[model samples]
Target: MTDQPQGAPVRLTAFVHGQVQGVGFRWWTRARALELGLRGSATNLPGGRVQVVAEGPRAACEALLALLRGPGTPGSVTLVVEQFGAARGEAGFVER
Candidate 1:
């Protein structure tokens, strides 16, 4: 096995679409990430997409991603995740 830590946190970019902006998406993610003891930020992109970067244990990160892609109202949300290497050193979670 490798010598690296097993539970080291990660950095991921999640693109949430469909009624994401102005729909409390950032708030929801911030709340959830905090509850999960994760750190990162969520923001609205130019083209109707909400982007989030969460850094924490793998399990919690996965849960956050699942919620981002869950079913919704008439205009349901779709989450596209792009896993990055890891969190360099983000301070905390916030809206940007």
Candidate 2:
């Protein structure tokens, strides 16, 4: 458990490596983020990686990160690099 207040907004930036691009991974991430009521974007980066930035309640962001690292996601994930911070007041989730 964390000491942060409940429902406090937070940002989750995750760099997912391995077979993530051209595999509907962004779409899947968008769906999951929307379902969690998060606002962010999933963008395909160079060197075969996907960058997922999500902002919302800390719990929601953590959930999204968990899903990103868990099984059943599109393509295969060999490594998940995560960073957290205060939310930036963004809206809507997009795939890029």
Candidate 3:
């Protein structure tokens, strides 16, 4: 459990590694982020990684992080590097 205040808005940036690109990973991430009421983007990086940024309530963002690391994602995820901070008030989740 995190020490953050319940429902406090936050930003979660996750760099997902492994077979994540060209596999509908961004679209899947966008769906999950939308479902979690987060606003950000899932973008492909140069090194075959997916960078997922989500801003929303702390708990919601954490849930999205968990989903990103879990087995139900579109492709095999070998690693997930995460960073959390204050929310930036983004509008909607997008697949970039």
Which candidate's lDDT is highest?
Answer: 2
lDDT tens digits by residue: candidate 1, 1-96: 123367887777787777777777788889888998889899889999878898877778888777677663224586565565566677789998
Model 3: per-residue lDDT, tens digit, 10-72?
A: 889999999999889999999999998899999999999999999998889889999998989
Q: Which model is ahead, 2 or 3, in terms of lDDT?
A: 2
Predicted structure 3: lDDT = 0.90
- List model 2 lDDT by residue over 26-90, tens digit each: 99999999999999999999999999999988889889999998998999999999988878888
TM-score of each: 0.83, 0.92, 0.92
Task: List residue ranges in candidate 2 displaced over 4 A.
Answer: 1-6
Each prediction's whole-model lDDT (CA): 0.76, 0.91, 0.90
Which residue pairs collide in model 3, if any?
Answer: none
